[model samples]
Target chain A: MNQRSQAVRDLLEAVRAKGFDPGPDGPPPDRCWHEAQVEVGDPAQYPSVQESQES
Target chain B: MQVGELIARMEYEYGYRFQQGDVLLIGVNDQGMGGPQAVLPIEQATVEQQVQGIHEEVLPMVHRDYRNLIMVRYEEFDYHETNGFHDQFTASLDDHPGGFEVVAQYKVDQNRQLYQGYMDQQWASPGLRWTMPGKLPDVSAQMRELGYKEPASSEAEYLRSFQPHPEPGFQPLDQEQEVSHLNRLAPRVSVEVARHALATTASTESIEQQAKARQTLGHLVAYDEDARDAVAYDASISPAKKDALVETYRQAPAKQRPALAAAAGAAWMMSGGGLKAGRAIMAHAYQSTRPSDRALVTAAEVATTRAHMRPEEIQEAFGKEIGTDLEAAEAAHQEWERLYSSTTTQTETETVVETETVEEPDQMQLALEHQMNQPPAPVASSGPEVD
Candidate 1:
C-alpha cells in the first residue's frame, strides 16, 4: 500500500544513516527542505547546455 | 513568514518574480528532493517548453521513474502555520491525475500562509488521515512512519465508521446523514434535482426518502455541497466518503449510466409531480456521461419544455419507435401538433352542429309556410264542413 518502492525505502534509510533526518515527527529543518533527493550523477555530465546554446 | 516575505524569498532564490500566471515546475524524486526547477512566463513558453519542463525535467524526479509533473501558475505565494510554517502558493496543477485539486487560500490581502502544494498528500491536517485511508490506504501509515502524530479518533468518528443501516424498515435521516446521502448519491442523481435538493429546504418528501434521493442524485452528478442547512458540509461528512463516491462514479460502467440516469430523473419528476417536472427530469437525465444519451436527453428536455409535454407524451407518440435525438424532438413537436389539431377540429364540429340547429325553422313556422304554399289549412276546414 505504501507506494514507496524498495529503492525509495533504501534511499531514506541511507539518508537517515548519513545523519539526514526525514522528520518522522514533523517537518524537517529548513536546511533539509530541498535536499530529500540528492543527485547521484555528476552535474558536469549535464552541464548548462541550454545556456551554452544561448551563448 | 508573510506573503510579501515569501514572495521576496522566492524571487531572491529563483532570481525571477513568480507573478500571477508565471509557469513553474516542481519535481519530486524518490528521495523527495524537489523544488521549482524552471520558471518561465506562460506568455513566452510554447507547448513544447511546458511539456519538456514538466515531463522531461521535473517528472523524472518523482519517487517513481513515472512522470508526475506539477505545474503551477504563479497566482499568490505565502507562508502560514498549520502545525508548522508552510510556504504555499496557489496555482493550477496542469493535468494533475486528480482533476483540478487546487488549494487557493487567502487571508486579508497579503497575509502569511505557508505554501502547501495543491495535493492533499502535502497537507498537515489530521482530517487528511481520515480522507487518505480511502484514497491511498498506505499513505496514512507512511505519514505515521514519518513521525507525525495521528490524532485519536473522536466519538463521532467511531460512530461514523461503525454506523449501521436500519433493519429494512424506513428511518429518518439527520442533517449529517442527509449530507452524507447527498454526497454519496451525487453522481447518480440529476444535477438539477441535486442542486434543487441542496439549495432549498421546501421539499414535502420524508427525510429518509429525501436522503436516499439526494444520495442517488448526488452520486450521479458529482455535486458536492460546501454548506448544508447550518453546518459546514466538510465538517459534517468525511471527504473520504465523497472521494470514494467520485471514484466509484468514474469507474462505473459507462454503458449503464444513461439508463440509470433516466430512471433517477423519472423518479425525481414523479416525486415532484409538477406540470413541468418532466423538463427537470430530462434536464437531469441530460447530464449522463455518455454522449449519445446526453444528446438524446437534451433534445427530449428541449421538446418537453417547448411543448409542455412530458416524457409519457413523447413515449405515447413514438411508442418505442424513436431512435435519434432529432426523432424524439420531432415526435414531441408532432405530439403537440396532434393535440392542438384534435382540439381545433372538435371545436369546429361543435360550432357547425349548433349553427345548423339554430338556423332550421321552428315547427310553427314550418306549418305556416306549408299553408301559405298550398291553400292547405283553409281547404281542409271547408272540406270537413261539407262532409
Candidate 2:
C-alpha cells in the first residue's frame, strides 16, 4: 500500500482516532508492516491485534 | 512510473546524486538477524538507524536462496509493490541470507529519515501485490452486523479472498492439504529417496490430492505415521497424474471433495501401477528433474556486478545470523513443528489404502504398455539434474 496514498492517510486517521502516538522517530507505536501485527487499524488485515483487544 | 522518474524523485526527496550505481532501497522487514532490522538490498540491509521493536520472531525464517529482485536491481523498486501492508511493518526488512546494507549511503539525511539505497538493474518486473484476506474469521460484531457470508465455493472465490500470508508458517493453499506424505512415506523410503524424489518433481505437480485436500480441509499436516502415510500414498499418485491432476484441481470447487479413489482401473495405470511402478515413479520423482532450469550466473558476473559489497558488510550479516538469526529460526521452526505435531496427534484414524486389493492384471498390462510407450526416463539418457 502506498505510504502516502490517501487511503493510507484516511486509515492513519482512523488509527489516530484510537489514540496513538507515532513517536517523532518512528512510524507509530502500533504501526509497522502487516506482518508485524502492531495493528494500526488496516481493516484489510485479519488475525490482527484487534483479536488481542477482543480476548 | 519509469525508473528515471523514480530515481529523480528519490534524488530530489533524499538529496543525493544517486549516481548510476547508487543503492536501491528494496523491501525491508524488521525480523532479519537480531535487534530491530531494516533488510536492504545491499549487504547487511542499508539502514543507518536501527529502529525500535522489530518482530524478533521472524529473524530466522527469512534466510533465503532466491535473489530478491530488490537485491539485483536498483531501478526495480517498482516491481515490489506495497499491497495492503505498512511500509515499515517490521521496522527491519531484509531477513534473507544477504541481509542488505548501503554500499555508500547515496544520501543520508539524518533529519528526514531518508537513506538512498539502490540495487542493480536485474530486479525489474510487473508490480506484485500481496492478495490477502482483509481479516480472518473472528466473532466480530462489525462483520456480524454486516451479515453472514457463505464460505467460498469456487477457486475464483478463494483467489479473490486469498491473502498471501507473509509468514510461511501458515500452509499455502497447495501445501495445507499435503499429507506431508513425503515426510511420512518418504521416511519409509530413504532420506536420499525423499530428497531425490522431491528434487525430481520439477517445481510443479498435479498436487491435486493435496491441493484438493487443502481446499476442503482448510489445510492440514498429518505428522504421525498413519495419516502421514495416507498422505504420502495419495501423493504418490502425484507423479503419475501431476499434470492432469493440477489441471483438474485448479478448476475443482473450493470445498471438501470425497477422495476420488481409482476413478477407473486405468487410474492405476496412469498412476504408474503397482509397487514396482510406484518405486520407479517415486525414484524418478525423488531424483533431480530432467534438464533442470539453469541460472546461468557466472563468477565474473558475481565479481563485476554492482551487487557485490566490501568484506565488512558480509561479515556483519553473517554475524547477525550466527548470533540472533539461528535462535529465531529455531524458534519459528519449533513453533511450526509443534503445530504439525499438534495436528498429527488430533488425527482421526484413516482407512488403509487398498494397494493390493483386486489388482487387475489388465491394469498392470496397460501400465506396462504405457511405460513402454513413453520415452526413456532421464536416467537413461542424461545425468543428474539441478535447478
Candidate 3:
C-alpha cells in the first residue's frame, strides 16, 4: 500500500480498537480529509524539498 | 453515657422499642418556619394517627407556624439506609400550595425539602457512573503486536488523534458511534466551557466581564436548538423570552460569534445552570463537522487547561470529570503504555554509570546536604569588590 493509504488504515484501526465509531457516526478528523487522494510516486524520484547549504 | 444508653433511656421513657423497621413520623406545620416534631409510636397506630401525633407534639415545641404536616417513615436507622432512603407522605388539614412530593434522597435540600415539588437526581460525578453501554475489549496490546506505532506520549497522542488523518486510511464511525462519542464528551465539554469562561479569558472578576460572559452563554444557547432546549429545561425563562433571546442571537453578526456563544454557555453553567445545556452545546459542536474530521476545535477547547498536565494526571482528571467512559479510559491507558515503553527502551539504550567499592552518595541528596552545611554568602558591598 502507499504511505497515505497505510496511514489511513492505521487510523481506522486505532478508532475501532478504542471502540470509537468511525464517522457518519463518529467525529471527523480536524483536518480537511475529503480532499485527499491516493498519489502514485517514488520517494527517491523527487529531490528533497529542503535546499542544500553551500559547503 | 454512650449513644446506646441514651437510646435505651428514651425507649424506656417513651414506652417504645427503637429498632429497625419501626416507622417514625417527622412533620412540619403551616408556617413552614420552625421544627415540626418527631412522633414515635409506643403502641401500634394508624398512619393518620402517627402524622397527627407529630403535629400535636410539635405544637407545644414551635411557635404558631403549623397548619399542614408531612410524614416520612424511617424504616431503618442504619447508615446505608439514611444515604439512599427517600419515601415520604404529606398530610394537610388545609390546602397547602405545594404538597409533599417524593424527592430522591440525593436531591433533597440541605434542610431536606424538594425544589418546587420537583426532585430528580440524574447527574453524578464521572467515575461514579458508567457512561458507555457495554464492555469494550482492550486492544492496545493486540495492536502493538501487529506492529502498529504506539503513541509517543499521552497528551500529544490524544491531541494528535484529533489531527486530520493522524492514522492513514482511518475511516469515521457510523451514526450510532457519533451519537455515543458526543454523549460521552458532553459532560467534559460542558466542564471545559465553564473552565474557559472562568480561566481561559483575561479576567472574569469585573461586573462588565461577568455580564459579557453571561451574554456570550446566551448566544451559544440561541445559536443551537438542542442547547436552547436544554437551557429551557433548566432555566425558568418564559417561552416568549427564550424566543426573543434566540432571535437576537440569530440577528447578531457572524464575526467572532462562536466565541460569544461558547462564553454564553459557560455563563449559563456558572449561573446555577448547565446540566443539560452543556450537553447540548457539546452535541452541537460535534454535529457541525464532517464524519471523517477530528473534533479538534472542541476537543482542544476541552483539553486547553490540561495542557501542562501529565498523562496520569490527565487520566485521573478525566475519571473524576466524567466517571468511567470505557473508551476514554482505554485511550489514556494506551497513551500511558506507549510513553512508558518508549522511556524504558531509551533508558536501556543509554550507557550505565561506573560502580565503585565505596558506596556513592546520591548526587541530588549530596548537593542538598552540602548546601545545608555551607555558611551563608557575604552580602555585596556598595564599593567595588576587593581583589
The best candidate by lDDT is 1
DockQ of each: 0.01, 0.02, 0.01
Report, for every candidate in turn, its global Cα lDDT versus the true structure. 0.29, 0.24, 0.27
Q: Fraction of native Cα contacts kept in each candidate?
A: 0.00, 0.01, 0.01
Candidate 3 lDDT by residue in tens digits, B259-287: 32332322222222212233233333344
Write the residue-wise lDDT of candidate 1 on B1-387 in tens digits: 122222223232232223453454433222322322334444444444444344332333332331322333444333332411112221324444423222222121112222323325555643211111111112235334533334323212311221112231222223575346444432213232332333221231344433343343333333322111001111012222222222222222433333333433332221211112233234434655544334333323222222323323333222221111222222332332332233334543553354345442322333453445431111000000000
TM-score, every prediction: 0.18, 0.20, 0.19
- What TM-score is obtained for chain B in each of the predicted models? 0.18, 0.20, 0.17
Chain B of candidate 3 versus the native chain B: what TM-score?
0.17
Per-residue accuracy of model 2 over B53-92 as CA lDDT, tens digit each: 2223122212222111122122222224442222342224
lDDT of 2 by residue, A1-55 (tens): 2212221133233334435322221111222321211101111212222222212
- Score candidate 3 by TM-score against the native: 0.19
Query: Model 1 scores what on Cα lDDT?
Result: 0.29
Interface RMSD, model 3, angstroms: 32.8
Q: Candidates ranked by lDDT, best first? A: 1, 3, 2
Q: How far does residue B208 in candidate 1 sit from its true spot (Å)?
A: 7.1
Name the candidate, 2 or 3, with the larger lDDT value: 3
Clashes of each: 35, 45, 35
